[model samples]
Target: MVWFLQAAAAPALMALAAGAAISALAIRLCAAPVETAASAAAVLVGTDEHELDADDPGNLGGPHLRSARMVRHGAALSADLVALSTAGAAVGLLLGVPVLAAEGIITVLLALGVAMLAAAAAAVVPHRGRPGLERAALQLGGIIPAVLGGAAAVAAAALWIPSRYKDLRFEDVGLENFTDPAITGGTPTPRTELEPMIEQALTDMGQWVSQTDESQYASAFLDVLTLYSVTPNVVVAIALGLGVLSALALAQLLGGAGHRFGGSVLRAARTSRTGGALGITAGLGSTALLAAGGIALLVLVTAVLNVLAAGVPSLALALLAHAGLGALIVAAACAGPLLAPVLADRPEAAVGLRNAAAAAATGPRGVMLLSGLLTALAALGPVVSALQLAPRAATIWEDRSLHALTPSALPLLGGIALGVLTVLLVTSAVLDGARRLGANAVVETRASLLEGRGRAELGELAEMVRRAAAPALVVAVLAPIVAGFGLGPAALPGLMIGVALTAAGLGLWMIGAASTLENAAAVIGSGRYGGRGSWGHSGALGGAVLTGTLRAAIGAVALPLLLTTSLVSALAVSAVVGLSTDGTSHFLRWGVAALAIIVALTCWVIAATAPEVDLEDGEAELSTPLFARADDAPADTLAAMDWEVGDEDVERTPARARGKRRRGAADDDGRAPEDAKD
Candidate 1:
């Protein structure tokens, strides 16, 4: 336990510190351009001849002046940080304290130590630069020393605190103590204690497999499902709906963040016109890819671990692998969403990849910390589910004497829900961070990329399909196929109905959710909502929130409707099967074929009608002094004067002929017509 704690604690603290420093520095650097622009505006508007002090708030003068100065100085940056940190901290405390309460003083000390170190690093790092991947890297480089120092301090404190508080069971912090039977709903047993039971179950499974004939394979499969009572129906619908809704919320958040980050990168590139911007954008994208790759690797590793558990039966090794897998998943989830929006905004794939990597490596530390904390919270459901299944497995082994037990669907459902929520929250945080960083970047940038309005529409649709595809396919295609082969002809119609309902519900939900998210993004990006902190921005955000909430609510309400429809369809098909006794099997087969066609056609239509995003031309709208203000005065006032015409002639003889007349006026004080009177 002590060794595990040491292993986990060190890296966790280091990452927390590093992420905090990076986030703080990114915040400052991203705001620099906005601040500089604001300062220029302040100088232009100053009525006094005296140079205004940029650093001194007192010297800023009047309310309007101060407001201008504050805006120029990146007041929104501070406000953003305050909001993010306050919310993040509240979430972190709520999740972390309870989870780590068993660790007692050690957890508190480690948290405090990490916080202090991160703060010091953030304070010491230089944050001035063009707000992009390269600048983030420089800031990250500056904070390395501070992070290392903080880690060392934490380690020293960890070592000393246990000695001082001798009563603290530091050794109890291992995996053995971490498992809770109450939460997991299983009798908590050590690997060594459960090894005998595992071996007995394996032996029984081997005997059963040996006795089963090839013709009885389908029957065996059906028996397994019957024993587990795992059927696709209303429960599946509810789970699918919840999962899709969560994914939609996440996509909305990530899309918004990506747009803002892209805007910032583009603005920075415009000001600097350097190749570095492209490199930075590519790096950010790569970082995101790397995070995604890590997730894929974790999935593979988890599969391998499961195989090992079932085949080789190494309890200790499996537990260790599980622990490691959990950590890796959390880390990947944190890094992936955080950098995804920044990378996705770039037009060039290579640029996005590089920038994502750089941002991941050197961007906001606070974001990383928050992501990690949230990931931990999201992981709770899966961990608890796993614990709950442990006892169920033991029961299967003791009663049925089966090595491979089909687990209840409840754990999987709970895990999916929790996973979706995690993704949503992480994406939201990422989007919010990107928005803050890019708030000022929008002022000078043109309406290029259509402000992500069009792109968001298409992106949201694609995102919905991507997120819901796996779960829906599993329920619709896989479940029915399995039931057809395993449960025989009678069970086919019920499974077919399940497939149809799942497909229809998923397709409908996807369209609705995508539309809502895209509309929200369009409203927020329109600038009608006052850009960042304005009342308009607030309103836009409110509208977006309401849209997402409403969509989720609608999905929830519609779940029962879907379930009821699926049941009726199944009942109708079953009645047909029973009535057509002579050709019941043929009738069932035709029914299944018809259902499959309907599902396929529905999916195709949804895909075909998905929104398309058109990229905007890069050209900026022209602005010149010639049209600085409206020319509202009379045309004659603006017309060029004929210098050859005398002043008296300009007002006399027809106004048109005055231009042809020479300078033939009388005295300066006399009437101009003195000469013309004759």
Candidate 2:
């Protein structure tokens, strides 16, 4: 009854303690800022006044008159408020010593550590290149280092403290009394008495099983157990490792293939294919690494959980979930490369790969079907067990100790997650770089086969591709990290959705590029061969057509992949755990929403680009400012203009008739014959 009462009172006591802490901190926070503001105001206005300026509006210098002065005062108050709030929490804990002086020090250190963690938590939001983001970043930067320092100090204290009770019998100095070479047959004494030794052993074992406290011995034990689990589960370990490697390879294959396809389309286009190859290569490598890392991590984490659960039906279900997550992760990883060709206006390459994949998937559809069915059956083990004749079997399979078993799995899981993050970040950085390169290429000059002007355009294109790739890669990687850090698992689905969108965008870019290249080549060739009448259409229109097609295909593939993949599924699961909601329903809602958005965006983009044809042409037209303005000007001025319009300026005449007409006109006749008209 006493214990129960104590337990019941504990919750209320804790709540009261927490409330007191907050109240004390708030008081300090409020007081410091008020004092600071008052001092600043006195210094600025030469008097203490709550208002900024005196009654005169024109006199800005007065305490009661100037808005700027008031603003400064406000700023000071805000800064002081923050500093005091943080510092108060630190000081309050120091003042309130719950235990002995030594324990109090420990408590204060722990409080400081908490403060540091809180600061870091506040900084997880993205602040890069955004309005006010820099300020946030800078503030976070300052806070994190301080927090880290505090954490280090706390950790040192924690490490120095005694891990286990020194009162244990084995620690007694009297154990040394048992030392005797002759009686013990030269064996050294254990130092502890016989009865104490037995008691201590049992106590140690109890501690080990219970994981009662953090200690050097406990940590070492856990580490050894983890290592043992990893070593013995060789099959699972190998599978996990291979999963990562294979995912990487697959991503690379997709990226490379996409890159190649883009290059091919660009080559057919007859435009400069400067960074296309590099983009393809980087894209492929990045994709592969990310995909493999994600897969390896999913497999490792799920496997650990499954084994920990003692092969309960839940394990199979978890594995199935993990497999789905792996697929999504790989899909997300490959998106950039897969969409690369399309973005480059390389429809042929994109189409070829797309067709090939679809055909392959469909060709062995039965195998896929059988495999899926078997997997489903395996996953249903838990449900089947619930309906089984042997209830004892289920009970026998109940989860045992997590301590010994989870160690191995945790490391593998952490490594996998880290690996995936590394790959994604690297890939995103590369892509972002490429994107910037491509954008810059618009102005970049190169050694061209055509005129100086044409060379400039090609150079621009090359530079654009090069610059853009890095940024694209950066964006790709950043998304994953931001998702993981800021929103935990919920952020993952966002990435999948974002990747899908990006893939679609890239695809359109490729298609448009291919069309433009083809048109340019045709135009140049026609101009050289005097085939203007036969072929004089603008390249921009064709490019637009290609871009539309590319974008469409990307959207088609991306939407499904994003909706169905494991990466998003994992995120959904995480959301469920963190938010305590139904993951399946949440994911379904998200997928449906994404699909709708994709459909809407596709329609909107297609409609917008359809009439204009080549979206890039408008930009090209803008680039040729003088030429465009001239074309738009009066026809008379255009005719009189000295600027060359290529062969378009030339007069037309039949081959044989022109000479005969000239010769007849030259003959000494007052009036030229009907056939000799000039």
Q: What is the Cα-based TM-score of model 1?
A: 0.28
lDDT by residue for model 2 (489-536), tens: 323433443443333233223323333333333333334222222121
Measured by lDDT, the strongest candidate is 1
Instruction: Quote the lDDT for 336 in model 1.
Output: 33
Q: Residues 235-305, candidate 1: write the lDDT tens digits.
A: 12222122222222333322322332444323322222223233233323323342333233334433543
Q: Residue 178, candidate 1: how far off, in angstroms?
A: 14
Count of backbone clashes for each model? 29, 78
Candidate 2, poorest ten consecutive residues by summed lDDT: 359-368
Task: Evaluate residue 453 in candidate 1 and report its C-alpha lDDT on the 0 to 100 scale.
Answer: 28
Candidate 2: residue 87 Cα off by (Å): 43
